[model samples]
Target: MGIAVNNINKKFGQFTALNNVSLDFPTGELTALLGPSGCGKTTLLRIIAGLEGQDSGQVLLDGEDASSRHVRERQVGFVFQHYALFKHMTVFENIAFGLRVKPRASRPSESVIREKVTELLELVQLDWLADRFPPQLSGGQRQRIALARALAVEPRVLLLDEPFGALDAKVRKELRRWLRRLHDELHVTSIFVTHDQEEALEVADQIVLMNKGNVEQTGSPQEVYEHPTSPFVYGFLGNVNLFHGRVHQGVLDTGGMRLDVPGHAEAEDVAGIGYVRPHDLDIERYAKGAEGIVVQLIRAHAIGPLAQLELARDDNAELIEAVISAERFKQLDLKEGETLVVRPRRLHVFVDQPSHHNQDAR
Candidate 1:
């Protein structure tokens, strides 16, 4: 089922949690609500699930007004970060809870419930642990059980709030990949809230990036990462080097280097910032009259196929980071204290504005 919120607004005492937020979550696709804490991602998700009411605006499910519906009425499955499984019940009972709680006329028979629970356990690949209590299961196993429980009633929409946040790095990685595969099989309209950029990038079909209670950008992972609409989006989505400079006649000149940015080609001079991802920087051994900024290699780390370098610009003593293939690093035979010339192969320039100004009033 497709979900949408229109002109949504919410407040908490003196602070506004959401400001005119609107978004469309296409049917049968996994969409991620991504942002740092206090960005209202969870609040927005809650409102959509009918757990919290919006101060104004509407929540629509399948093009029908669901803003006034109760949580039960919405028939949405929700999974929390910490597994909220019943401590006293066996995993089997927990998975069967939702089905068993339906009104008598609608509830499935005991035999049917048993078959459904068993099928769900196998779907999550945890049928072997059906008799174990929540405490007896590992964190990852418990989370999978929580998911099975949520799916018991066959909800039209599934909402997960940082479902893998509590797991170890390796477990989180495993679970996210599993979640993606499960979504493909079920084809349910799903929305998950996460602060981890990597998680959203790897799992979701589309990403809705939020900040300071407002949606900043919404697009496929590649689109948002490669074509950010704002400085915040560019910086938030990944590691980037920012060069503070002044733009004059389409050229942005920092103290160390300059780049042609025709997009901001106004004749008038203005403060701007040039953004360059570390991987986009081309590094070379410095020559006496070489083009690009000259920097001294301060640190180098090679792990697997990638090399991460830290350099200090000679002119301003500002730090710069670059990433290159491990093979290239070996070819250079780089050592600390050696000077190198670095130039950005691509640049994105945006007018400088105070970040605090984008935030809503407290």
Candidate 2:
């Protein structure tokens, strides 16, 4: 089911939770509502599920008005951060509860329900544990069962609110890939709310970034990551080194290093605050690049094939970071406080506005 939200706004007492947010969640696409705490991602998801009413605007499902629909009428499968399965109920019973208790108009026959429940159990790979209670299962197993329960009802849309927030790092990583495959197989229109930037980038087909109860920017993960529409988007999307500089002689210069940004792109646009990600930075001791004094060297971390170097730039500048291979670092004989050339082919320049100004705001 394709969902089209137009002019949607929400308010809580004196605070505005959402301000004229408009978005299109195309059918079969997994859209992520990503932002910091109190950003209203949960509020938006509630509005879609009919749990919270919007102050104004419309929610159109496949071109039909659904704003006035009841919560049960929306038929959205919701998964919460904490698994809400009944402890005494077995996996089969928990997944079967939704269908068994649904209204007569929506409920299927006993045989049909049995078939559907069995199918969902298999889909989530918990069929053998049908008789097992919630406490008998691992966190990942419980999550899978929760997903199975939600899917058994065959919802028109799927909504997840930090579904993996309670799991450990390894389980969360594994579940993300599993969810992507499940979405592909089911093709249910879905929206996921997350505060983790990496989760948003890895899981969503489109990302909606929000701040202060308002939408900041909405785009594909790559589009938002590579060419952020606002400074907040740049900072919130990934770990980036920010520089304070300006355009001199039609050239963009940051910390005395000239960038190759074209004149048409507005050198001063990001002049006051230029940005570069860890992957974009290069490290070498004074090899004709962005020169800076290393005031501090952060603890090195071994992240698979790459090594991360976090450096405190001189003069209280934002932390400069670079990701390099351990082998390359050994060859260069890297050390603490050593000067390095940090040159990147691409940099993002936000217009010289107050740091508070963002990409999309009411």
Candidate 3:
């Protein structure tokens, strides 16, 4: 079932942790709560699991109020970053712990518990490690066991708090793919908190990007990356080149150069900012009649398939970076300290108005 958080607010003493946050996690879909540390992603996850109470508003599980429900009654499966496995118990026992500890009336019989534990172990691909102690298992294996334990209770919703955070980079990547496949097979409504942009982009069907106490934007990976709604969203999602200047008569003058910005007549007589991604910039040899910004190349590094160039504006020495394919770099044959013309294939401009309350706000 889907989960809905409506107008939720939370605070710690004088500090506001979450401010008027509202979100929807679609039924049987994996959603990622993504943000930097202290952005309330973890706090929101805890609140949904009934582990923490909100100062205001409600959490609805399939349209039923779940705010007052106890953690166990909520039927939420939670996995933490650390492998909270029992050092004294075997893998099979760890997965059976949840079922065995249930109230007598609801607890499964001993034979049933063993069967269920066996199934979960097979599902997590760790049946071979059933008799191994946690200390004998690898980091990835322990995490998989932890997830199997969470699923043993047949939770309605799964909440993972940086579940792969303790693993190495390669292991983390592999586990994310595994988790995605597991979700597909089970179709459980799951929400995981991650500070990693790549993880959220790769693993989630929907993404909620939060900063401070507010959600900056919510969309699929492609939607958010292609069309960022705010400056913070653009900056946080990827690299961006910024141009600050004054706009007049559809032209922006940065004191060093002027850019012709058509269809921006309303921005006349106001300060404006322009943003362009490194890949959107086109570089070429400077010609006398060339119509583009002139910049001097500082250095060029060809690493793997992409070549990165460090450039500086000729007039004010403001630095910029451009990334292109190695094939294009070889064709251009760029040299250090040489003047080059740069044209932005696409640009996003916004009035230079910063919001005091929401820094990412337009």
Candidate 4:
């Protein structure tokens, strides 16, 4: 079943945590609520789970209102950052806790409960650790146990709040891939909240980007990355270089360099800003009649497959960065203090006025 949040609003005293936020989580697909801290992602998640009440609006689970339901009745499973496993319980016992706690009339028989726990342990590939206590398991192993426990109850929807946050980087990466595979196999409707962009991009089928209690954009990883709808979206998604200038006709003049803006329909002469990602920047040795901005190289470092370069505009001393392939860097043989012409292979322009119109890459 799908979940729909309609016109949800929440406030904590004078501060508005969520302002008229609405979103749809498709059935059997993973959705990620991605944002910085204090952006209301967690608040919205809690509200959907019936752990927090909304000031206004309703949460619908499969087209039925679930806003007033108790957390247990909602049939939603939650996994937090910490494993929250009982130190005294073995892995098998921890996984069986949910089933055992059910009312006697609804509880499964002891033999059935044991079988279910065994199946869940095999599903998580930790059947060997069934007898080990949480204190004896590694951080990653503990998280796997936690997820197995969450699934033991057969939740209608699974919600995870940074479930892998406490693990080490290597473990986090490994678990992300594992989780993606697990989600595909289980086909459970799941939503997870995280501030890590890479995790969202790699693990989720849909991403809802939130900021300041508002949704900036919602799309697949590639859609949002290739076509950002706002300056905030562009800046938040990846490394971007910003240029402040004024637009005349279709040209942006930054006092030091002019960028040719083609197919821009805005007729009003106004200040505008331009954004170009590091990989979109092209660098060449300076020469006459070159159609690009002239910049002086401050430094360059070859990191694995890419070379990161710091450059400054000759006319205004504006700083920008460019990342190029190591092979290209070697071909150019660039050095510190060398003059180079920089051009954007693709650019995004936005009008800096009362109404900002974001121009997609062209």
TM-score-best of 1 and 3: 1
Q: Native-vs-model 4 lDDT?
A: 0.91
- Please give, for residues 1-362, the per-residue lDDT of candidate 2 as tens digits: 99988998999999989899888998999999999999899999999889999999999888999999898888899899999999989899999999999889978999998888889989987799999999999999999999999888889999999999999999999999999999999999999999999999998999999998778888899988876777888889878877667654344566556554443243334445567778876667664433533335555665578888877665676677888898887787767766665666456655464442222110
lDDT of 1 by residue, 189-224 (tens): 999999999999999999999999999999999988
Error of 3 at 255 (Å): 4.6
Model 1 lDDT, residue 257, Cα:
77
Clashing pairs in 3: none
> Best to worst by TM-score, what's the order?
4, 1, 3, 2
Which of 1 and 2 is the better model by TM-score?
Answer: 1
User: Which pairs clash inside model 1?
Assistant: none
* Alpha carbon lDDT of each predicted model: 0.91, 0.81, 0.88, 0.91
lDDT of 3: 0.88
**Residue 313 error for model 4, in Å?**
2.1
List TM-score per model, in order: 0.96, 0.90, 0.92, 0.96
Candidate 3 lDDT over residue span 1-362, tens digit each: 88999999999998889999999899999999988899999999999999899999999999999999999899999899998999999999999999999999999999999999999999999999999999999999999999999999999999999999988999999999999999999999999999888999999999999999899999999988877777888888778888787877667676655777764655647787777789988899999978777899999999899999989987774588889999999998888999998877777666654421111211
Model 3 worst lDDT window (10 residues): 353-362
By the lDDT metric, which is better: model 2 or model 4? 4
Candidate 2 yields a Cα-based lDDT of 0.81
